[model samples]
Target: MFPLVFLTVIALDQLTKHLVRGGMALGESIPAEGFLRLVHIQNTGAAFGILDDARPWLIAVSSIALVIIIWLAISRRIGFLDNIWGRLTLGFIAGGTLGNLIDRAYYGYVTDFLKAGIWPAFNIADASMVIGMTILVFLYLRSEYPRSQ
Candidate 1:
């Protein structure tokens, strides 16, 4: 399951990046209109543009993190990828992580193409990661709530 999810994400991420790289130029933005656009930007940093110039370190850290996450999902049997909610969340994150990891390993940066007003340009993988995390949080909260008193 993890492998399948990872592959799907990586395929989608690479395909999108390839299309954007072939069609758009650096710093160029294509308006999707209504607060959305496709822009080509290479990020050598982590989320929100942190550590913008630490490619090697970022790669190392991300790789390690990915391994740890996978291990936890498989070994500890965490709820982040076993049931429906877990599967969905893990699928998104696995895909996103591999997508960015591919960039770090091959291009020394992550290729970000999707953009929206006030939001950084990101790719499908990033979206998956964000959405996955959001779902995980929602599930956690739901589980914590007391049943009807």
Candidate 2:
């Protein structure tokens, strides 16, 4: 399940990035329906374009993150693979990390599209990472600190 979800997210993310790169020009925007549009842009830094000049460090950090995730999975540190939500979390982070990692290694940047309203333009990888992290936090809090009855 973990591998399946990871691969699915990576495949979908890469496919979308490939399509956007091939079909759109950099900085070009094609409006969709309301408050939605397709865009082609690149982010060299962390989320929302932070640390714009730290490509090497960013790559190193991303690589380390992937390693730690893999280590945990293999060693069963978090037992994430055994739980459904945990698997989802792992898959999301792994997939998202791998997706952006590939772009960073190959292009020195990550491709981002899928713009909506005032929010920053982001790709599937970003969405996956955010969703996965959100799930992880929710689960952790639920398990570690039960609500008062």
Candidate 3:
């Protein structure tokens, strides 16, 4: 399950980026009639283009995160990960991290295309990371909360 989710995330992320790059010119945007838009933009930094000048640092951080997540999943140090959902969450994080890391290594930037009004443009990798982390946090909180009779 972990491998399936991980590979699926990575494959979808890379494939979407590839399609966008091949079909759209850099900085080109197709505005939707509503809230969504597709824009070809390269982000040189982490989320929302922060640390634009620190590509190497970002790569290092991403690599470290990937390692830690992989370790946690394999080590079974966290009890929650004994469940399928927990493993899937970790897979999402690992796959997303790898997806962005690949882009930073090969292109010196992450290719972002999906855009919604007022939100910073983001790619599939970013979406996966956010979703995975959100679920992990929920799991943690749920475990820590005191259940009443």
User: Which pairs clash inside model 2?
Assistant: none
Q: For residues 1-149, what per-residue lDDT tens digits would candidate 2 score against the true structure?
A: 67887999999999999999999999999974458889999998889999996888988998999888766655656642447777778889989999999999899899999888888899999999999899888877777334542
Ranking by lDDT: 3, 2, 1
Off by over 4 Å in 3: 32-34, 144-149
Residue pairs with backbone overlap in model 1? 81-86
Cα error of candidate 2 at position 103, Å = 0.4
Give the TM-score of each candidate: 0.86, 0.90, 0.93
**Candidate 3 clashing pairs, residues 3+ apart or interchain:** none
The local lDDT score (0 to 100) that residue 2 gets in candidate 3 is 79
lDDT of 3 by residue, 23-66 (tens): 99999888644489999999998898889969899999999999
lDDT of each: 0.81, 0.86, 0.90
* Total colliding residue pairs, candidate 1: 1
